[model samples]
Target chain A: MSIMRLLLVEDNARLASLIREGLDRQGFAVDWCESVAGAEHALKINAYDLMLLDLGLPDGEGLDLVRKLRRAKLMLPILILTARGGLDDRVLGLDAGADDYLIKPFQIPELAARCRALLRRPGASLGTTLIVGNISLDTAERTVMVGGHTIEATPREVSLLERLLRRAGHVVAKPALEGALYSMDAEVTPNALEACMSRLRKRLNAAAADVQIRTVHGVGYALFAPVSTDG
Target chain B: MDKAGNRKTGPTGPTLFRQIALRLSGFTLLFAAMDVAIVVVTYSSQPESLAQELLSLEAERVQSATDTDPDYLAGPPGADRWSARYIDDLGEIAGASVGSANGGRLMDWTRRERIAGGYRITGVRSVVRHGKQHWLLMQFEGDGIRPYAPVILDEIVQHVAVPLIPLSTLLLIFNIVAVRRVLKPLRQAEAEVDALDPDNGFHRLSEVTEPREVNTLVRAVNRALMRLDEAMAMLRSFTANAAHELRTPLSIMQLSLDRLPPGEVRDELQADTQHMTRLVEQMLDLAQADALAPELLEQVDLADIGREVVAAMAPKAFADHRDLQFACHGNTIVLGHAEAITRIYRNLIDNALKHAPGQTAIDVIAGPGPQLSVRDHGAGIADEDLPRLFDRFWRKDRRKTDGAGLGLGIVQKLAQVHGGTAMVENAADGGAVFRVTFLAAEPAKPA
Candidate 1:
């Protein structure tokens, strides 16, 4: 698989380097730009898989860059990485055509997870295989493998498992899971999504998968690799 | 208290209209008094001369009577009671000359002297009647009535004082209308001042439509407001800069920490960083609560905001092993800042999650009215600590809680900015309930 390349536009050198180091460990190649001018120049020279744009830059506003790229019909997914935590700023950034927003002081793991989630969307450049720990699900083949062995699963279980795998290690809210598992007009009972989640959990566990499905009671579910006992 | 101070203390003080009316009445009264004084002085000083003129007038009347009819003067006295006598010379009268001569002729030769009970005015005129030169004497006796003083006073009362009553009343009415008309612009400016929202620095009292005096005052107030706006803008920008400057380095530290291997020390450092982040965010929220402008407010559904906030915080509550539930009833439309309203619910739920024990339910209820309340199943707040719950930076057992105690204070401030109230009370069912009520707005009709 080809490496995922990201263009990061941030003014603070220390923060930019730290983000680069974090993303590099997550198997992403990051190109850092310290100003809007540098970012624009880099965008012209490099075809990036995604862009992490900061709102405040030395040369210009990052919102202006997002608008310019969108006006030029660039479909690359852009995630706003900034310290502007105001709700108005968040709405303004999203309305200016950025794909997502992450406030500063965020965990690097969370940032990488958000990037992966954005890339795994339909028509995105990411591959069809979703992996967390030893469990892997292939969207193109509609199959699940645990430790190189196939696991027979129902279509509904596969759908739930795919949604969980997409946002692995993060709590996926119950409404989001329901939206993924049911049609809009489907009259779903309150326990219907929980029932599906329970089935998926049982199937993955029965296949001796290295992942665990944890229920944050009354909130949602999360998938995480089991803590190694050897540690 | 002194009379003036006492009047000022209550509603008994004279209004601007009444004060102007009274002043006008006082001026009219002074003019009336001057009218009376002029009448008295003229009547008292000129009586003697007036009497001499009357005597001369009688003599002339007799002369004209004789010209018309030779026997007219020889006839008896007329109704005016002037006794006429013929004398060879005027030296018989026992009185001094009281009239002046003009052109070497005694044009008015008259005298006045005190009689037994009154004064007499007598005049002598030499004339030829039937070709005989003789002196004609005419005398007038007046009893000591002295009715001029009372007459003058009565006339003044009838003409000057009586007329002045209605005159001053009309003046008073005119004055009231004039005062109101002159103050119309000031009243408008007063309304503008009352309507000015302190959070909205753009509001200014109008200077164009006011009178010159009021315009000066309004211009001064507008200048002060301009200065206030500058200060507020500086404060807001400072807050933004502080957020950026503080959060950037914190983010770097968090990123570096995430790279450390899993251990107790790493976990403890992560916790400390998380606490610092929360503190910074709360401080920023406190600053923003003061900056919610009137333009940012709108008709939003408290139920909608309540549901969204509950759903968003449910994960945190669940991770802490506490159940979070939301309930809504009826229309909960309110005039509010939507994001601020969301923060209110978030803070209340966060507080409940922290205070309530694990395995307990935290219920968030949004109204039958424009109110949202959160009830947590835990030991209720102590009676003594309830009063300070909403105070900024005040905490109960500060060491026990991880928060900086700014959550409730922000809730209260945001509620107040929306023209609402936030209240806390210990519930009877063994928990504390926090309720925030907002100004209700009319629901929109279906299109």
Candidate 2:
């Protein structure tokens, strides 16, 4: 069977190489591009299960590229990697067609998890159910089962968790998580979304022994992988 | 001169542009005065000479007419004062005004009780023996005639001089208009340069087509903007990536320390963790402040933010042995972002608590004429330190304080960011009062 294809577009050579190597260790076949031009050519030549885009590309503007990619009918899940603190820019990036955004200087494990989650999205050539230990989530039906014990979640929670479980080792910001909680049109306050996060953190508490949710303080929250060695 | 010199550095007021224009206009007025002086000098010297020439011509004509026929020079029958001599004799005589030297007279027959026409006739009587006959001959000057030429000359001068006033007035107007038109591009370039957002890292100076001298200047500015945008973009990504990557190590460090279970080692570790947390928070705050778009102009309530900050700090104030109080009078509407406004107040309150003598109270009063003053009753600043108080990373006694000394600098930047101003003064009651004034939004009127 063909392994998952991940496209990591980061301008920093060292960081990109480190990420590619780590994702390779996690069973992902990784290809790295440093700029928008390289990324474009790479995307054209080979199909990617997921495209990890850094907003600060050297050649052309990353946002413009994301817009271009979407305009070209490329439905590959794009995860925007950015370091900006402003909600406005994040909103603009997501609105421009990024499925999710991870702030810069991300943990490699979380990057891999987000990559897998994106690859596991419905449009992925390889249709796979997300199985976190015994709990399995069906992307098609958007259903969840834990040891045959089914629990109903709000549509928003399902969407939010899908993104979290997909990038289980990384901390996600409240705003980006909030974007997943609602569709492109809905208005969710930082506080209201905080309330939902409270609910999700509590539910995940039962499985806290295997999985951990950590807060980055003033930033957003993050979900850690089971084998998160350092965290 | 100053603005022209600083033009390379940045934007300036109309002071220098006006200075040059004023000097040019002074030259114009000087030129006008010189033109008037020339007319007066030419008129004073030439009119007498011109009158003598007119007398000679009249004498020659009368002598010739007397020699040809004596009756020709005499007056016609029934001729009155107003009738032209040319109408009576038709060719031999012309009655007009006399010259100024001849008492400013006009024409009349026999020169009796001369009424002014266009000239005056002056009389000179001479007796001479011609071939044994003593003849009494009256030599008369056509008084009206001399004044006639210069009057036409004066009329020509008047016509020319009259239009020049309006023309120069028009020229003055035209000068002002022309200056304004030419300076338009320069002014536009200045405005665009002024509007460049250092925070956004996105400034497009489309006004590159300036005067040849400044075209390169605009190009240089755009280049600088390009460099800034690239650097900022890189910084943004680097910060984000670094923040994310460090989290695992940071959490692992915390988790490893957390598992040590509340002992000396753990306490030390926790303190270190908190310190790290503060560092992270600072980095994030600095990154945020850097990324803040200067274009976020809004009518924010400083008083409301003040109250909120004070209320939020109530617990911290009690712990620090200080009082955080708010004295807001009314809705203080100033144009700024809500977040920045809140941050400004928070920094001010934090600074007061951090610097004030222990057990002293800090009172913040907002909502007074677009100005928010923060007063602390404690050891006030020395006059020496007042000027440099707002400089970044500047602290008079860092050992005595528990901050990075960025609070006041942040406040100052906040003041500038909101199109406001800040002033420092020691209040009479032995305290340092920092007043931040965010000018109220101008009320828009109907067109």
Candidate 3:
């Protein structure tokens, strides 16, 4: 797959460089701009997959830039990174047409995970092949593989695996997983989703996948790749 | 200053209506007394004039009686005390002196003299009765011929005191109405002052329509409020700028630490950075809660906020090996600032997570009074620690210093800002329940 391109609009030079380096390690090609004008000029010339914006820009507010891009009919997903951690600020950022908001002083891995979550939306630019650790699901082919070996799984388990693989490192809420697994009008039993999740967990375990499914009781489930002990 | 002085004198001090009413009643009494004095003086000094008036009235009756019947001898019906006699000449009464004649009357003269027991006033008039010239004489006698003090008092009571009752009542009614009319603007100004919220800098007592004296005070108060508003605004902006300045560097440090190789040193630094981040976030939250204004409040669903907070904090609770659960009963709508309400729930849950033992579930419940409560199955707070739990920078144990102790303070302040309250108590079985209640609001109707 081609490397996904990202535009990083941030004023702080060191922070911007560090973020770019971190995103580069996550297999993203990041183009950095220090001001709204520079960002606008870059957007005019580049076909980027997504934009990472900082609210406090030198020339203009990042919210205004998002609004301008949305008004101009640019459909690329924009994630706001801001030092303003107030709840009102987050609401305002999303209300002004940004897809997601992340408060500052955040971990790079979390940031990358959020970016991937945004890209994994139905119409987003992310490819059909979803990979988390040794497990990968090819959406176009409707198949699941562990360590390059195909696994026998029901269509329901495959769909559940795909949903989990899309948000691999983050907790996908129970209601959200249920919504993704069933049609809106379907009459689902109380334990149907839980039963499916258990079956899928067993299947992954039997196949010796490197990934692990962790259930956060009363909250949701998260998939994590076990840490490699070897250097 | 005057208002403060008035307040210092206590609530029983005179009001404007009382002061005006007292002065009016005083003037009414004074005028009533003066009227009585005048009546008494005039009645005492003019006794002779009164007697002369009675004697003349008697003389007319005698003349009319002689004309009707020449042998009439009985005194006029009600004037038996007056004596009447027919004489051919005025020389009959010795020591009789000629008195003043009545103006515009023929053969009418009055004479007054001291008798044995009293003074006598005699009025004589010449009348041609039965075609013969005869003089008709009438005399009135009384001790000193002066009105008694009690009689004068009776007259004054009848004429002055009786009428003055309704007159003074009318005057009092007029006084109350007039005073209320004059103080109406002041009462309205008082209401405006009462409605003024200290956190809302834009609210001011109206200066227009107030009386001149009260307008001066209102203007002074408005000026003070304006200055206060400016100072508060400066303080809030300073806090906001401080937050920005502090968090930017913290973000940089966190990112830098995130880029480091996986090791114990990096993990320790990351934990320290996380602690600092929590501290900064709590401090900023406290500042924001402090600056929350009444105008920013709106109808918000406590259930929605509770669910969101619990969902967001569940992962953290999971990391600590605790389960976070949320349950909402009926409609949990309340008048509040949405963001502030969210913070309140987050803070309570955070506190519960920190205090509750590992592997226990923390339950967040919203409902009933539109109240949000967080309960954890851990050893309850000590009795002595409950009172100081919400105080800023007051922690139960100083040795276990993971928090800066500002979270509960922020929670309490935000709750109060939304016209709500925060309280903590030990549950009957075990664990501590921290509850915050907001003023309930009616649910919105569908369009």
**What is the C-alpha local distance difference test score of each model?**
0.78, 0.63, 0.79
Runs of candidate 1 with Cα error greater than 4 angstroms are A125-152, A169-194, A201-231, B1-14, B49-112, B115-149, B158-160, B206-211, B256-273, B289-312, B327-341, B365-371, B383-388, B397-401, B413-421, B436-447
By lDDT, the best candidate is 3
Over the stretch B1-447, how does candidate 2's per-residue lDDT look in tens digits? 154754555556665447766776676567666665675556446655433333333434444464444335533212222111212121233453323223122112223234454333332212122333222222233443333354435544564567666776676677777767667767777788777765656767775464665677777777888998898888876865565456435544543454466778888776777556444544555556556666776766776667666655654665554656667766578777776677777778877887778888888888677878888987788999988998877889766424666667767777876777777889887988988988786664567
Binned by DockQ into CAPRI classes (incorrect, acceptable, medium, high), candidate 2 is incorrect
Kindly list the per-residue Cα lDDT of model 3 for residues B1-447, writing each as its tens digit.
155754434568899889988998899889899998887677668765545545555555566665454325544333325666677777876665544433323436666667777666676776666787667776655564242334455567777889998899998999889889878877787778767665555588777654677778779888988898898888877876687678879988988997789999999998889898888888788778887776677888887777667767765676666777877776688998888888888888888888888788888899866788999899999999999999999888878758999999998888887788999999999999999988888668787
> Which of candidates 1 and 2 is the stronger one according to TM-score?
1
In order of TM-score, best first, we have 1, 3, 2
Candidate chain B TM-scores, in order: 0.67, 0.52, 0.66
Question: What does fnat come to for each candidate?
Answer: 0.41, 0.03, 0.49
User: Could you tell me the C-alpha RMSD of candidate 3 in Å?
Assistant: 7.2
Q: Chain B, model 3, TM-score against the native?
A: 0.66
Pairs with steric clashes in candidate 1: none
How do the predictions measure up, each by TM-score?
0.75, 0.40, 0.74
Q: What is the DockQ of candidate 3?
A: 0.42
Interface C-alpha RMSD after superposing true interface residues, each candidate, one decimal: 3.5, 12.0, 2.7
Candidate 3 backbone collisions, by pair: none
Q: Which candidate has the top score in TM-score? A: 1
The residue-by-residue lDDT of candidate 1 on B267-318, one tens digit each, is: 9999889988888888888778887765677899887777667656755665
